[model samples]
Target: MILKINDLSVRLGGSHILQGVAFDVAETGVTALLGRNGVGKTTTLRAVLGEVPATGEVLFDGRPALGRATHRLVRDGLGYVPEDRCVFAGLTVAENLRLAVRVPSPDFDLVFDLFPELRQRAGQRAGTLSGGQQQMVAIARVLLNPNRLLLVDEPTKGLAPAVVTAVAAVLERVATRVPILLVEQNLAVVRRLATDAVVLEAGRTAWRGRAADLLSDADATRSLLGVGTTAGRH
Candidate 1:
């Protein structure tokens, strides 16, 4: 396993956000973390990266990483892409990618190939790009560096169908090389890309199994996600 969490718990401002959440991510596959809003999906990711105060055992490559700083986590081969697509406003696309590299890696060519628009717009300011383009910048930023695990929080939220397809393809390619702990709500993308899934309800893991199993079990989906809709709908 590339990542492991056991009995993870978190509280914020007198509210319990995570309650003994635990899950494992393998070295080379995408593990989708699925849940409705305000269910601590984001908090779980933050706690894993030490962005939120929590009590837990986080093991990366079988080593304890509970209290490590955020930069240390990145330096140790962890990459994160928040839902907001936080790219530097004044920086050019190339500059943003250059700044995200924690270690020397000769993967710039691969990054450009994955998102050709970034290469064509290398000199454009990151803040001016469209939402999909900015998302590409964020994902490409992590690709420029060496990574064993990626924590992606909702890559397709608010994106057009075409853009979602594009980003999904990039994520597909990324999963080929590094393990991904993805928190995505798009059931279609989850069904198409995720090998396994861990569903969180009220900050605790409620289900764990193959992605296909969850997709096929409509009762399980409606009970866990509060939606009876099928994949690729709404």
Candidate 2:
């Protein structure tokens, strides 16, 4: 396992957001974190990166990872592409990616190869880019560095069908290199990219199994995710 969580819990504003959420992320491929809205899917990813206070056993590469600062975790080879493609609005495309370079020699080749448009629009202001373009910058920034695992939240949210397909293609290529802990609502994208699946219900882990098995069972999909297998299909 590249990442492991045991008995993970988080409380925010005096409410329990995650209650003993636990799962393992394999060293390769995408692990889909599936759940309905408000089930702490994003919170779980935030907790793992130490963006929110959490109590539990979190092991990253077999080392204790809990309580570490977010930047330290990033420096330790954990990459994150947050929800909503949080790009710097004032910065240009190249500048946004430049800010993410941590190593002496950043992997520009890989990032440019994955997102050729990012290179083409290097001088364009990120705020002026379309939603999908901004998302590309968000993902491209993270790919500039080497990472053991990537915590990607809602990569396809609010994107057009064509844009979603494009993003998924980039993610599929990226996953071949680094393991990804993905929080996605789009079942079609999940079916395409995820090898393993973990479902969260009411802030706790409800199911963990092969992605194919979970998606293939309509009853299980409806029960846990509050949607049918066809939900969010492009």
**Cα lDDT for residue 80, model 1?**
94
List TM-scores for all candidates, in order: 0.97, 0.98
- Runs in model 2 lying further than 4 Å from the true structure: 232-234
Give lDDT tens digits, candidate 2, residues 1-234.
999999999999999999999999999999999998999999999999999999999999998899889899999899999997889999999999998899999999999899988889999999999999999999999989989999999999999989999999999999999999999989999999999999999999999989999999999999998888777454
TM-score for candidate 2, residues paired by index = 0.98
* Residue pairs clashing, model 1: none
Error of 1 at 148 (Å): 0.7
Best by lDDT: 2
**Which 10 consecutive residues of model 1 have the lowest summed lDDT?**
225-234
Q: What tens-digit string does per-residue lDDT give for candidate 1 at 1-234?
A: 899899999999999889999989877789999988899999998998889999978898778888889888888888999999899979999899888877655489889889888889999999899999999999999888888899999999999999999999999999998989999989889988999999999989999889888888889899898876565454
| Per-residue lDDT value at 15 in model 1 | 94
Residue 25, model 2: Cα distance from true site in angstroms: 0.2
